[model samples]
Target: MSSPRFAVAQLDEITPTPCPCGQARRAFKEPWNTLATVHLTDIHADSKAHYHQKMTEIYIVLEGEGHLEADGQIIPLKPMTTVMIRPGCVHRAVGKLKIINVPMPPFDPADEFEV
Candidate 1:
């Protein structure tokens, strides 16, 4: 057997998992790729404020309008809006939204901290 150099993930085929946000379909979560990971997130009105100690996340809004609360600052969000969140920045999405999240250095559950 040979190791594959590339991987593919179908967004719709991926199961949505519960997170601080509403639900998320994550791709490239395997240990083979530690540089980055991608997620399709459906944000809920009650998304909790949280931060990552090691990962930096880039969020690109895909649907609906909302606001991104970062470090107590409210930033409006809309379709195509993009936000880059650094480590330790307390943040959460308010209102219903769909976004594509790209996490650098990958995402680790242990690094997630509630604010």
Candidate 2:
């Protein structure tokens, strides 16, 4: 038998975890597959400002309205709005939103820093 070259994850089956932005269900989080990870996040009102040193996060708003505060700038957001946040940029989402976030180089719990 040959080993599968790709990995599959059921996003709905993945458990949601508390994150800086809200609750998130992440997929493709294996250490060996470190290229990227996909996250479905439900943004709450109390999202915190945080930065990642080695990961670049791309956020795509799937529902609701909001604004992204990134490096002292506020960017308005709505459904279909996309924002790419680079390493070292302190950012957070305000307002109710459901977003799909893709973290390049994958996401590391240790790399997240609160600012």
Q: Which tens-of-lDDT digit does each residue in 1-115 have in candidate 1?
A: 5546898999878999988988999999887786888999999776989999899999999999989999989999999999999998999999999999999988788988988
Pairs clashing within candidate 1: none
lDDT values for all models: 0.91, 0.92
TM-score of each: 0.94, 0.93
- List the candidate 2 regions with Cα displacement exceeding 4 Å: 1-3
Q: What is the lDDT of residue 63 in candidate 2?
A: 95
Per TM-score, the best of the predicted structures is 1
**Compared with the true structure, what per-residue lDDT tens digits does model 2 show for residues 21-85?**
88999999876785899999999895999999999999999999979999999999999999999
TM-score of model number 1: 0.94
Q: Any idea what lDDT model 1 has?
A: 0.91
C-alpha positional error of residue 25 in candidate 2 after TM-score superposition, expressed in Å = 0.1
